[model samples]
Target: MIKKSELNRMADVANDRGVTVWVEFEGRRYGVTPPAATPPLDDTEESDLDRELEAFKAKNGYR
Candidate 1:
Protein backbone atom coordinates (compact mmCIF):
# COMPACT_ATOMS: atom_id res chain seq x y z
CA MET A 1 0.00 0.00 0.00
CA ILE A 2 1.38 3.39 -0.98
CA LYS A 3 1.02 6.30 1.37
CA LYS A 4 -1.16 9.12 0.11
CA SER A 5 1.79 11.47 0.19
CA GLU A 6 3.83 9.16 -2.00
CA LEU A 7 0.96 8.63 -4.44
CA ASN A 8 0.37 12.34 -4.71
CA ARG A 9 4.06 12.93 -5.30
CA MET A 10 4.07 10.42 -8.15
CA ALA A 11 1.04 12.06 -9.70
CA ASP A 12 2.72 15.46 -9.47
CA VAL A 13 5.77 14.16 -11.32
CA ALA A 14 3.64 12.60 -14.06
CA ASN A 15 1.60 15.75 -14.48
CA ASP A 16 4.78 17.77 -14.90
CA ARG A 17 5.68 15.59 -17.87
CA GLY A 18 2.36 16.24 -19.69
CA VAL A 19 1.09 12.75 -18.96
CA THR A 20 -1.85 11.12 -17.29
CA VAL A 21 -0.56 8.51 -14.93
CA TRP A 22 -2.67 5.64 -13.56
CA VAL A 23 -2.24 2.94 -11.02
CA GLU A 24 -4.31 0.17 -9.50
CA PHE A 25 -4.36 -0.41 -5.81
CA GLU A 26 -6.49 -2.82 -3.79
CA GLY A 27 -8.93 -3.34 -6.70
CA ARG A 28 -9.28 0.37 -7.28
CA ARG A 29 -7.98 2.44 -10.16
CA TYR A 30 -6.25 5.75 -9.69
CA GLY A 31 -5.27 8.25 -12.33
CA VAL A 32 -3.95 11.77 -12.64
CA THR A 33 -3.65 14.29 -15.43
CA PRO A 34 -2.61 17.88 -15.71
CA PRO A 35 -5.36 20.18 -14.51
CA ALA A 36 -5.12 22.26 -17.69
CA ALA A 37 -4.77 20.61 -21.08
CA THR A 38 -1.50 21.24 -22.89
CA PRO A 39 -1.68 23.12 -26.12
CA PRO A 40 -0.78 21.48 -29.45
CA LEU A 41 2.68 22.13 -30.87
CA ASP A 42 3.00 24.49 -33.80
CA ASP A 43 4.15 23.51 -37.28
CA THR A 44 7.81 24.04 -36.49
CA GLU A 45 7.60 21.75 -33.50
CA GLU A 46 5.71 19.14 -35.50
CA SER A 47 8.33 19.26 -38.24
CA ASP A 48 11.09 18.85 -35.68
CA LEU A 49 9.38 15.75 -34.33
CA ASP A 50 8.97 14.40 -37.84
CA ARG A 51 12.69 14.83 -38.48
CA GLU A 52 13.55 13.14 -35.21
CA LEU A 53 11.25 10.23 -36.02
CA GLU A 54 12.80 9.81 -39.41
CA ALA A 55 16.28 9.82 -37.95
CA PHE A 56 15.29 7.29 -35.30
CA LYS A 57 13.73 5.03 -37.88
CA ALA A 58 16.79 5.17 -40.07
CA LYS A 59 19.11 4.47 -37.17
CA ASN A 60 17.03 1.45 -36.16
CA GLY A 61 16.65 0.18 -39.72
CA TYR A 62 12.89 0.57 -39.60
CA ARG A 63 12.73 2.19 -43.03
Candidate 2:
Protein backbone atom coordinates (compact mmCIF):
# COMPACT_ATOMS: atom_id res chain seq x y z
CA MET A 1 0.00 0.00 0.00
CA ILE A 2 1.25 3.45 -0.88
CA LYS A 3 1.52 6.00 1.89
CA LYS A 4 -0.40 9.26 1.72
CA SER A 5 2.82 11.23 1.46
CA GLU A 6 3.94 9.12 -1.49
CA LEU A 7 0.60 9.66 -3.22
CA ASN A 8 0.93 13.38 -2.70
CA ARG A 9 4.46 13.29 -4.11
CA MET A 10 3.22 11.49 -7.21
CA ALA A 11 0.48 14.05 -7.59
CA ASP A 12 3.07 16.80 -7.42
CA VAL A 13 5.08 15.19 -10.20
CA ALA A 14 2.00 14.77 -12.33
CA ASN A 15 1.10 18.41 -11.83
CA ASP A 16 4.60 19.47 -12.79
CA ARG A 17 4.31 17.46 -15.99
CA GLY A 18 1.05 19.27 -16.89
CA VAL A 19 -1.04 16.25 -16.00
CA THR A 20 -4.24 16.64 -14.01
CA VAL A 21 -5.03 14.69 -10.88
CA TRP A 22 -8.01 14.16 -8.60
CA VAL A 23 -7.53 12.34 -5.33
CA GLU A 24 -10.10 11.26 -2.80
CA PHE A 25 -9.69 9.55 0.55
CA GLU A 26 -12.18 8.28 3.09
CA GLY A 27 -10.27 6.56 5.80
CA ARG A 28 -9.71 3.04 4.40
CA ARG A 29 -11.40 3.78 1.07
CA TYR A 30 -9.60 5.78 -1.57
CA GLY A 31 -10.07 6.82 -5.19
CA VAL A 32 -7.62 8.05 -7.80
CA THR A 33 -9.00 9.84 -10.82
CA PRO A 34 -7.64 12.39 -13.25
CA PRO A 35 -9.65 15.58 -13.41
CA ALA A 36 -11.38 16.73 -16.55
CA ALA A 37 -9.26 18.77 -18.92
CA THR A 38 -10.14 22.28 -20.08
CA PRO A 39 -9.29 23.58 -23.49
CA PRO A 40 -7.60 26.91 -24.09
CA LEU A 41 -9.52 30.10 -24.75
CA ASP A 42 -11.65 30.07 -27.92
CA ASP A 43 -13.07 33.59 -28.03
CA THR A 44 -10.68 35.18 -30.50
CA GLU A 45 -10.80 35.71 -34.28
CA GLU A 46 -7.75 33.49 -34.69
CA SER A 47 -9.57 30.60 -33.07
CA ASP A 48 -12.48 31.09 -35.45
CA LEU A 49 -10.13 30.94 -38.43
CA ASP A 50 -8.42 27.95 -36.91
CA ARG A 51 -11.71 26.11 -36.78
CA GLU A 52 -12.49 26.97 -40.38
CA LEU A 53 -9.00 26.01 -41.53
CA GLU A 54 -9.28 22.70 -39.70
CA ALA A 55 -12.52 21.95 -41.48
CA PHE A 56 -10.98 22.89 -44.83
CA LYS A 57 -8.00 20.66 -44.19
CA ALA A 58 -10.27 17.82 -43.19
CA LYS A 59 -12.28 18.21 -46.32
CA ASN A 60 -9.10 18.24 -48.43
CA GLY A 61 -7.27 15.57 -46.39
CA TYR A 62 -4.41 18.00 -45.84
CA ARG A 63 -3.88 16.74 -42.33
- Name the candidate that leads on TM-score: 1
> Per-model C-alpha lDDT, please?
0.85, 0.70
- Per-residue lDDT of 29 in model 2: 47
Model 2 agreement with the true structure over 1-63: per-residue lDDT tens digits: 668897787677666766645455565644444455797766787889999999999999997
TM-score of each: 0.45, 0.37
Best by lDDT: 1
Instruction: Give candidate 1's root-mean-square deviation (CA, Å).
Output: 11.4
Q: Any residue pairs clashing in model 2, and if so which? A: none
Candidate 1: what lDDT? 0.85
Q: What lDDT score goes with residue 14 in model 2? A: 66
What is the lDDT for 30 in model 1?
Answer: 82
